[model samples]
Target: MGFSKLFIFLFILQTLLAMALTQPTDQKTNIFREYIGSVSNNVTFADVPINPNVEFHYILAFAIDYTTSSSPHPTDGKFDVFWDTHNFSPSEVTAIKNQHSNVKVALSLGGDSVKKEKCYFSPFSVDSWVSNAVSSLTKIIKEYNLDGIDIDYEQFHADPEIFAKCIGKLITTLKNNGVISFASIAPFDDDEVQSHYLALWKSYGDIIDYVNFQFYAYDKGTTVYQFMNYFHMQSSNYEGGNILVSLTTEGRGGLSPENGFFKACDMLKSEGKLNGIFVWSADTSKGLGFRYEEQSQALLAVSHLHSLV
Candidate 1:
């Protein structure tokens, strides 16, 4: 071959090698397969009937309340699931996973702490929470055969480093466990949460799957511009892959499906940055033709090539 031809061949070879060296979607498969939703922990799996029509890749069990500190720490694998904490089974997870082959169901830690202070606050700082909670959390994930853990420890005091460190360790350890397929952190469009979580996302983002940002329940992020900005900021932190944008399904959100939510969804989908949509609840939208879940899924169903390279 001539000199120019040989040079072109070498350039192509090097580019292919570089692409090969890069990791999968986020050190794993592409998380943005279809869509994602959350089933509120307020009711048991039995309470909410599954809609055969709706499809989602992930469905996070809304939350688990932290009651007391026992051996292995963090409520001893016993979760306040559904309505009541008493009487539960790991089979619940199996049954849910059995519902959808692609759907991953993981237990979320912490929810709105209106009645209680926080399941993750108080004596447990980032270090303490991770150290103490690891054993029991591991036991739960393994025994339950659950997909992964969702870190929603929102009642943080002043320590962002500990929070991120604790989360980073949890993701690393859980990923090491092998059963935990995915782990996610819940942050909102706030300085405190975003700054701390950005630390984790920047450093150990490869280990985690999605940053399930609570785009509602906050004062701001009501308009299309606001919503776009919120998603943009969250997406900025996560340079790995698509970040899941969760909005309130019930009347909890300020943005309307006919307005801001739809506009943002379209823009994100077109950009190929949209991962999926997560609705705050199943309880409110499951029955009586509420259509909250249905509408959100439809808006997120925007399609584009995963890679044009």
Candidate 2:
């Protein structure tokens, strides 16, 4: 071939290569973009095996303990209260990032056993609490490069109006600062709670990205199926797809993933209300030394269903 022809061919090949390089690879998916995934079943610096085929969209790490009293220590006394990003070095965060590149890591703030007083009490009086939370969250995100924040405050009944307003403000502030914000709320079977709070959440839907409904811990007065039916019935009224339903496998008043959780997901999917599933905490179900294999299997089952769909 002539030298000019060879040069032209090389230029075309280089252009093709440049285009391929600019395109995103399948492994490095978008993080800020919404997707389905599991909550981190093991929050500690342990070897947690994540399914490669199933994209782990969100992995929530436990940070501050907003509970009223001191948290309970395991037999080893490893994960005590006051455990946050400060306790875990940069290496721990790096380990999680390495495991799942597409995962959005959000730091959770409260737990079910938390005392109402320890929560944001100024929700009724001052708006500074929102600023304080935003400041702390921004610091954490800057430090660890997290994707967003998850508000796990369990004191929903203390001051619903002020609490919702504070949440709306916090979410708006976070979004304005280029961060995503989500809240975990209690599930309702009757219209009593929903009548008051559901409207508030709907009104502020533009600010809040998603809401993880705690469908467990409800009164299992009847069979598990009956309880799940009641939960589904309540969720029917609210906007469906944006809601994430969480199930607990082991706790004082918990439901097994096999019976309550899987069934609940199936029910939601049938009604076109299922968005995703989030386990309560890594320590409670899989992190602690009990029923690890069972929880793993349950998670695998969910992942498998996602694959088929």
lDDT of 2 by residue, 75-100 (tens): 11111123344434555667766866
- lDDT tens string, model 1, 221-293? 3888887776776676677644776666566665667556767777876776666666666555545353655
Q: Which runs of model 2 end up more than 4 angstroms from their true locations?
A: 1-46, 57-81, 84-87, 113-120, 156-158, 181-199, 220-224, 258-260, 287-309
Could you tell me the TM-score of candidate 1? 0.71
lDDT at 256 for candidate 2? 56
Which pairs clash in the backbone of model 1?
A: none
The per-model lDDT (C-alpha) reads 0.57, 0.48
| Regions of model 1 farther than 4 Å from truth | 1-65, 68-89, 120-128, 287-290, 299-309
115: Cα error in model 1, Å: 4.4
By TM-score, how accurate is candidate 2? Answer: 0.64
> Scored by Cα lDDT, where does model 2 land?
0.48
Q: In candidate 1, where is summed lDDT lowest over 10 consecutive residues?
A: 27-36
